[model samples]
Target: MTSDTAATAATPAAAKSPRALARARRRHSAVRFWRAYRTHKAGLIGLGTLVVIALAALFAPLLVGADAQSVTDAPGEAMRAPTGEFPLGTDQFGRDLLALLVWGARISLTVGLLAAFLSVAIGTVVGITAGHFRGWYATVIMRVTDWFLVMPTLVLAIALASVMDRSLWTIVVAIGVTTWPTTARLVRAQTLAVESRPYIERAQALGGGHGHIMTRHVLPNVMPLVLAQTTLVISSAILTEATLAFLGLGDPTVVSWGGLLQDAREAGAVSAGDWWYLAPPGIAIAVVALAFTLCGRAVESVLNPRLGVTR
Candidate 1:
């Protein structure tokens, strides 16, 4: 073939080479991850439960229609026991227990996911910085992480929540800030491991800048661990928000699992034997938390083969 003919032929092959190979590898890895996750019974159950809860939260208004927003205790409905029309019974305020719980799922899940995202974001930045730099910055970052580690998370969250305005965002911020240290430590460990690898050394030798290397090389390698940690963090964040709300620091206007518990407590449900009002929200919290925990553990097992946890 002539020079121009050969060059034209090579262009098509080269155009599909690296990008195609990279995409294939990504697809293969995703398939492998899914295969592993699917075999995990607890993980599947957790994922299913979460999906159901998420669907419920998304369609809560539709589920209960206008009654979801209506005050239930207005006339004859106040503190009524579970019956055909009102499945889960009525709260002291006569709100349908089922409706409240459904709506509460939206608030609870929103706070959980968003707060966890915030925690993960902060943790990833700090961890990546500390792991890549390995100097004074590293020292400062790890020391701060350790300090947060030493403090009681719940107590610190309470103190932080107390200082902030009692709102959903305040609850989210309080939970997120207090919860990031664990994630930071986890990410820092993974980053250190990735930073020391041969590929990373090669990237450094090629004069790749810190930002580029950290984002491209280190971040991708540590993402599996970060993802597993994020699942666990979501569960923790939910519980923490609930705790803060139960302690009377939660936003009063917003309905949430924690708020439900708070209302139940304040209504003397414990003394009145109102199992209908209290059990649903508490059970919802436990089930959702358990779901996340199971899925997180499965992901951790999949990512870290050394654990050798059987599906």
Candidate 2:
């Protein structure tokens, strides 16, 4: 009888293990989303393109022996069509277009990544506090966000970057500071939804502090939204950097896409039928941005099935 009872108890515990695993499997739906996303052709291509661009930008010097900033011409190398020496071609200034494009990835990636990180950091804190706390803190945070939202992000960045000697760091800070409102609003909505969930309420009732509730209970749920927003914002930041460079506010010191375009314009590449100068950087920007955008759209579809999901 003792052995029978022990066996029966052990069976229930063993059965409960399966049930617990099933529940955990259901709770983390990210795996399902990834599995679904993998089947998406655009998602896979965009991901691949992004990886290639990141790698090229990171290892431009190693990948291409030609200096991105150096205007080199071997007389034979001058304005050469896409050949072994210049896979992409040479610029109007006789600079290696391929080298410029490869190096420009560094600037785009830097601006995008740094700005996105800053926006997320500031937005997450303000958003969590505002939504979870729900008081003057919330009001103040939202109102400040409102003020930022009203300001023209690109225009503001132009003004700020222009005034600060037009350095890479200046552009990074300017873009980061101006482009956080969208993230804050998105995160705040997610935080609010998370705070009202049954688990969150239960945590609160179980003597969890506000900080503990926000960090432990709320953060995990809202992270998906943050991640989705990150890809999209990085795309926007890259474009913004290009725009700054186009408008003569780009760092002349670096061979970024914007600077490449600027050099083309100055050298009259388009007017002179040297489409080589204008096309490469434009294509580079479009390619990188398109990759991010495609991935963002796919992630958005998964994260927020309906527009009402507020991720």
Predicted model with the maximum TM-score: 1
Residue-by-residue lDDT tens digits, candidate 1, 113-226? 999999998998889889999899899889999999999999998998999899999988898888898888888998998888898889889999999999999899888888
Candidates in order have lDDT scores of: 0.89, 0.81
| Cα lDDT tens digits for candidate 2, 147-230 | 999989998998888789878888888888889888889888988887777888788789999889988888888888888888
**Which candidate tops lDDT?**
1
Q: Show the colliding residue pairs in model 2.
A: none
State the displacement of the C-alpha of residue 213, model 1, in Å, after optimal TM-score superposition: 1.4
- Models 1 onward score TM values of 0.92, 0.84
Q: Model 2 Cα RMSD, Å?
A: 4.4
Model 2 TM-score relative to the real fold: 0.84
lDDT assessment of candidate 2: 0.81
State how far residue 259 of model 1 sits from its true place (Å): 0.2
Model 1, residue 87: C-alpha shift (Å): 1.5
Model 2 alpha-carbon drift over 4 Å, by segment? 1-31, 66-68, 72-84, 306-311
